[model samples]
Every structure is written in C-alpha cells, then in structure tokens.
Target: MRVAACLMTLCIPAVSLLAAGCPDTGASYDDFAARYDKINPGTTVASGPSQCETPLGSDMEATGNWLFTLSVKLNPKKAFVLSAAVTAEMQDDGSMLVDMSLQPLSATDQTTPVCGATIEFTDLPVAPDGSFAWVLAPNETPLSLCGEANPISMSEILTGLQIAGTICGPADAPFACGTVTGIVEAPLPDFDLTGSSFTMQKALTDGSFPPPVLNCERAPADF
Candidate 1:
C-alpha cells in the first residue's frame, strides 16, 4: 500500500502539468505581442510629443503596449534558451506589422543581430482584441547565404537571408478555427537550419507549440 501511494503521488503532479496547457499563450499572435510594451524595452507611455514609440518606422500612436515572455524552440530538438519579446503596431491600411526582439535569457553581453530581427512578418490582420493571424507569402527575391541561393525569402529591408513557414492562421490561438484549416501543398523551403538548409537562428517552423522552460536555474533573476 505504501509503495502504491508513493507512485500515485508522483504521477499526480506530472498529470497536472500536462493538463494545465500553456500559461502565457496568446489569444492570438497579436495578444502575446503586448508583452513587449509591458517590458518597456523601447516604447513607453510617454505623453505629448514623446509617447508610445518604436524603432521600426515612424511612431504610430501614444498608447503603449505589453510584453509577454513565452518559450520557443528551434529545429526539432533545440529549444530557445532565451525568451523572445514581441511588439506590434497597426499600419494605416489596417494591417498589423510586428517587431520581434530576441532576449537570450542568458548571454550577458547582448549579441549582434538578435533572432527577432531575422524575419519581417507583415499584412497580418488584427482582431478586436489586438491579436493577429499571420500567413507567410512568397518573395520574388531568393534569400541566399554565402552567395548560395537559400530560396527562402527576401527581407522587407531588401537584404540578406530570411525564413518563412506555411501557417495560414494562428494554430495555437486561444480561439478555435471554424473552418478553412487546410495545409498548403508542396510548401517552399523553410529556415530549418537543423535540416539540410543553413540556419539563421530563427523559429524552425511556423506552427505554434508550447513555450519552452528555462534550461538553467542560474539564469538572471529578472528572467
């Protein structure tokens, strides 16, 4: 009886964690992005001339946003040791454009070209709650590394390599997809560096999975 009770006790917590689902999941991709403004990396609730701002383009508004830290993995095995921050603003045309900044939960010196700056996701439609659904589109310009045609995408900056995946909407959004959840056939090359293609340290695939847990306990207290 004692042994059986111990086994059952151990199993309960494991089952609880599994049943809990993701804690910081976005209602939509747009919802999670507010996390960035919460962290106040750049934009703030400043008033008058100096209000909510961004490093992307021009200042779109004065109302600041929130920053939610979520976990992500790369390739099939490698998880993002650091958490990434997402922030966004709506363009005049009603389309939403986002700015992703990678904050390697480790790495004290802060490296160059954080993973967030790699892809330029635009034309996403923001819902009433400010959450967005995004889809990747093909670019005429092929992305290359070392003069080799990587064939992924052309950056909005019209520069070097970028990666794109084929999700029409948020696969892990809090809401349900009523219909039209079909996958695209024969998709283009992705940024899966873990596979044959060269990696640029971005999300391996576009599907939203649960955020990863911290690999180390010694990580910064702020993290």
Candidate 2:
C-alpha cells in the first residue's frame, strides 16, 4: 500500500506539470526548423515577445531615406540600384536593430535581386560604428535581407556579390546618411569577388512610398 501511495504522489506532480503547460520561452521546434532550413540561407522567423523587444528610437527621427546599389565587374550591365527607406533603433538589449524597405531604381531582373521582392528584415543587428556585413552562407548569424537569386551559375555569374558602406550615419537624427561606393572586383578568375566594394546613399524622392515603421515588438518574459 505504501509503495502504491508513493507512486500515486509522483504521478500527481507529473500530472500537475502537464497541466501547467510548456514554459513561455518563445522557442519551439518549428522556430528551430524555420531558422535552420538548409535551402534558404536568409530565411527569418518572426520573433516572439520573449525573443526581441521594440527598439528604443522614434519613427521619424530614427529613420532615413537611402539608396543601395550592386553590380558585378564581370558584367557591368548585370546590375541593380534600389532606393531604400531605412530605420535604425537601439534595442533594450543594447543591440541596434535595422529595418529597410527597398525599391528597385534600376534592375537587371526586378524579380530576382539582392532582397527578392519585398526588402524588410526583422531583428537585424548593427554595430556601433554604423557598419554591417551580410554573408551568404548557411548557419551564419547577422544575416542580410537577401533572398534567393535566379540560379546564376558561378561560372556564368563569374564573381561574388559585395556590399560595404555606412548604413546608419553617426548622428542622432534622420538615421542613414553617408557616401557609399560600389565596385565589382576585377580579375576574379576563380569565381570570387575578393576585393569588391559596396555602399549606400540618401535617395532622391518626389513623395513616393510611405515612411517605414519599426516592426519589432517587445514583451516581458513570463518566467
């Protein structure tokens, strides 16, 4: 009888735990699978409240209108120029978050460029120096908003993509502002753009798209 009573006590706690439900950690098997998908290097899962918080900057003062351009030195005509409305905000975790909306000013193929069709990336980090780099490799952090390209072979494309420049300027207002240059490394014989340059600038506007909003929302942890 004593043994059965002890077994019953243990089972009671297990049942209570099951009733309590899973912890609100904002982590799940689906989130893990989506984030670590083998096919897409830049696929991003929408963050839950526990995963990230709303950035600590204003919409108007913290946003800027910018332009981003990319090209391959091997084929100069195969290029794209996009006008981006950018916003940079400091998170409560002391990391900066950058969000951008890019529209193609000129594109070899509008459907298959750096950022695919819509260019909004949630929860991307930025450095204090206003510099960022997005590498196209699997399982890498600090991902760019780049989407899938239309299967341009390494031999045919003949060069690696490159981008470099000041994204968020060193000021407290009107976020992104700086001179940026784009270059495709020449003599890249082995399917690489070893020393290419990329950059961004303020875009000229005649009242086109609406201003971008800071998309991250923060929620306190239940634990």
Worst 10 residues of 1 by lDDT: 1-10
Q: Compared with the true structure, what per-residue lDDT tens digits does model 1 show for residues 128-158?
A: 2232322221122221111111112211111
Off by over 4 Å in 1: 1-75, 106-161, 166-210, 213-223
On TM-score, the leading prediction is: 2
Against the correct fold, how does model 2 do in TM-score?
Answer: 0.39
How would you encode candidate 2's per-residue C-alpha lDDT over 1-223 as one tens digit per residue?
0000111111111112111222221222233334323322443222211111222233343357664544333343343345666675775644466666555442333333353343343334444444333321111111122222212222211122212223442233223311112112222234343222333444335533222211111111110
Output the number of the lDDT-best candidate: 2
**lDDT of each prediction vs. the true structure?**
0.23, 0.32
